[model samples]
Target: MFGWHVPAPDQAMLISGGKSRGEAGLPFRIVTGHGAFVVPVMRRVTYLTLSLMESVIEEACVTQQGIGLAVKGVIAFKVGSDQASIAAAAQRFLADQDRMSVLTGQIFAGHLRSIVGSMTVEDIIRERQKLAEQVLEASKLEMANLGLVVDSLQIQSIDDRGSGYINSLAAPHQAAIQQAAKIAQAQADQAAAEAQQASAQKQSEFARATAVKQAEYQSEIDQAQATAQQSGPLAEAKAQQAVLEEQAKVAAKNAELREAELVAEVVKPAQAEAERIRLLAQADADRTKLSAQASAAEGRIALDQAIIAQLPQMMQAAADGLANANLTILNGTDGLNDAVAQLAAQGSTILQTVMQGLAAHHDVGQQGGAGDRTDPPALGPGPDDDAAR
Candidate 1:
């Protein structure tokens, strides 16, 4: 185990030895495995790493513009994984593995100078990727000879010695960008101020409108309250008017009833009494008229009977008077009878006149009185009648 060796995953182990040193064509074999053994007296083992490596180069090179430019760059490389390439690398660097980075940097430095010298200062500064590509292409074959592969090359910076060329190139574009930024900021500020003023105006108008509407509502509420307060008094006045109207109707009915009672109690009895008195007076007047008519008829009958009785007496008296008258007898007995007849006719005439006077006086008395007198007047004796007595 003392002479045993194991290689890492990224390394190769080489064994070189023989019994007498040249018995087997310099006695070398490459081993890539976990472990390998070597006899201490007959063989020797060496380990070679197979990892990626990086190198940086800084050099002053002259460009095609006849200006000296400082070029700085980085290169990445690795030992090839093929057997021949690995064997070539192991033979050269097995004694000192650190020499791989130094050799790679020297190779990249020489190629970077050659590529920069073929271009102008502007191309080296602006087209740095093109410069790196050309350097990598040129260094490819040389790195292969050293059992290396060039993975990438990068040109970091290119500068002229203390010249103001780069600042002069960027001046106009920088000034244009600053001017555009100032214009955009001024436009944004103006738009924001206008929006703020419009919002304030709208808020003020809304507040004023709300206050006016509220005042109108309050006025309506007050008017409604006033109307409510007066309703009770108005209703009471209407009720009083209705009560007075009912009382008036009752009084008028009572007056009509009193008028009817007066007509029945006073006027009706008076009218009946007046009618009774008028009938009694009419009856009395009729009785008086009938009584006067009856009396007048009885008196007229009595007077006619008395005048008949007196006519006989007056004829007798006339006969006596003729007897008493003495006369000579010229014709004897015939002449005396003629004188008696003449006297008798004269007495009859007087009796007729008296009866006529008595009837006339009775008629006069009845016409002059209102049923007071209805009898005939009495007659006196005639003048011839008294002489006879």
Candidate 2:
């Protein structure tokens, strides 16, 4: 392990002054990717970088038109991954590897000037990639001789050395782009303004239509209110008139009813009382007629009884007078008997006379003459008294 030599992933280890030798018969043996053993005092060891390296070249050159220009470019180069190239780079730059970028820049600077010299300033500016490719092509063999390989080349810029040539070439294109942008912006603004004007017109028309409709509606409302105002008092007056007519009908009906009530309460009762008085008077008249007839009949009966009672006393007085009479007896007994028979006949005549007188008195009383009609007339003595004397 003490005599072992190792290289980095980006480096190659070289060993010299030992039994091991390179494939190209060089003094050093190249080893990469792994370790190698060497005699510690006998072998001399070194390392060479195999990684990417950059070289920037900026140079003043003349174009084909004899115009002075400044050229700037960058080259990406590295050591070739081969035993021959590794041996060549080791023989030349192993002791001074830091100078690789400096020597590479010097090498590409000469090639950039040579390539730019064959082209005009316009050609270099318009075809910068072409210029970089040509420069890289011309330097490829020379770099390989140094054991370096060119990976890519880029032309950064080409200037006309304060002549204002590039700015003048691009001025027309910049103006065209600016003009297109201005036109597009103006079109957009015009469209927005037209749309705003159309919206404003529509709003104004709507406001006008709304105002017209509101005015018509208000007019109709006012007309209806006026009609109602005119009709109010007339309708009320008609209603009051109807009510008064009904009240009058009621009053008339009441008057008729009162008239009928008067007939029932006052007139009917007065007629009934008048009829009762007439009936009472007729009854009293009939009773008086009956009492008068009964009294007349009783008086006639009492007078007849008193007359019969007086007739018996009158017969006794006549018989006693006949007993006291003085008389001569010439056929005395026969004459006496004839006289008695004559007396009896005289009595019968006397009774007939008294009955005739009573009949005449009763007839006079029945004519309603002025007399005490309760009593009978008095009787007198009979005829035939003178013939007895």
Candidate 3:
């Protein structure tokens, strides 16, 4: 393990001298790809680092326009990883690996000068990529010979050494660009201002419309609330009206019932009573008339009987008186018969007068009795009865 050595990933290890020093032989080998290897005694091992690095080149060179321009640039390079590139780099930088960046910088500087000499100052400043590309192309073979790969070349800066030629050359275009930028900025500001004004106007209009709508809605809400507030009373009024109407109907019904009851209880009974009284009065009148007629017939029969009884008594009396007086038949048969007949006629006339007087007295008594009595009197004896007996 004393002769065993390992190389880093970015390194190539070279083994030399199996029998001779600083020589390539059977024992000499290049080790890469990061692993351990054997190094025999009396052999040398050299490790070459393969890593990316940069070099800076600053050179004052005269342009094709005869202007002294200082060109500053950077070159990114690395040691090549191929066997041939490693072998070539190992031969050149075997003992001095730190000299690679210095030599690369010098080489890029010489090429940068050559490239700047070929182009104008404007080309070196404005077309820095063209300058870098041309420099890269010129330095390519030289870097490859030294086992280096140039990854990129960039021109960092170009100076005109305080001469105002570059500024003078750029003045017109810079002024034009500044004018165009100012115009663009003014236009943008105008557009922004107009947009802000429009936005403000729109917001104001929206606010006004919203306020109006809210006012209208509030008014409607108030009206609805008022209507709701009045609804209870209105309903109560309607209910009261209905109640009153029902009461009126009941009262009317009561009045009708009362009228009907009066007709039944008072008017009908009174009418019946009046009809009964009229019937009784009519019956009494009829009874009175019949009783009067019966009394009149009875009186007539009594008078006739009285007159017949008195006629017999009077005839006997007259016969007695004539026998006591004297001979009264002067002319015998004819005169005597005429005197008797005259007496008989005079008796008949006096009987008629007495019957008339009795009839008148009976009528007067009947009238006096009727005037004194509420009921009809019963038929009894006549006034001429005592005289006739």
lDDT of each: 0.76, 0.81, 0.79
TM-scores for every predicted model: 0.48, 0.50, 0.53
Per-residue lDDT over 250-356 for candidate 3, one digit per residue giving the tens place of the 0 to 100 score: 99999999999999999999999999999999999889867876766575576666566555666776665555546568888888898888877876776676667
Give lDDT tens digits, candidate 2, residues 162-228.
8776667666766777787788778778877877887788788888888988898899889889878
Give the distance in Å from residue 108's predicted Cα in candidate 3 to where it truly belongs: 1.2
Better of 2 and 3 by lDDT: 2
lDDT of 1 by residue, 1-389 (tens): 79888889889877787753322343477777578777886788888888888898898888887877788888888888876677778877878888988999999889888888899877877798999899988998888888888888878877776665655555676677667777777777777777777777778877887888888888888887887788778878888888888888888899889889998998899899999998988998778666655666566667777777766665665655555655566877787676666666666676677667666755664565435554544444456654654
Weakest 10 consecutive residues, lDDT, candidate 1? Answer: 18-27
User: Which rank order by TM-score, best down to worst?
Assistant: 3, 2, 1
How many Å off is the CA of 133 in candidate 3? 2.4
Residue 44 deviation, candidate 2, in Å? Answer: 0.9
What alpha-carbon RMSD in Å does predicted model 3 have with respect to the real structure?
21.0
Of the pair 1 and 3, which is ahead by lDDT?
3
Better of 1 and 2 by TM-score: 2
The reply for model 1, stretches above 4 Å from the true place, is 19-27, 183-389
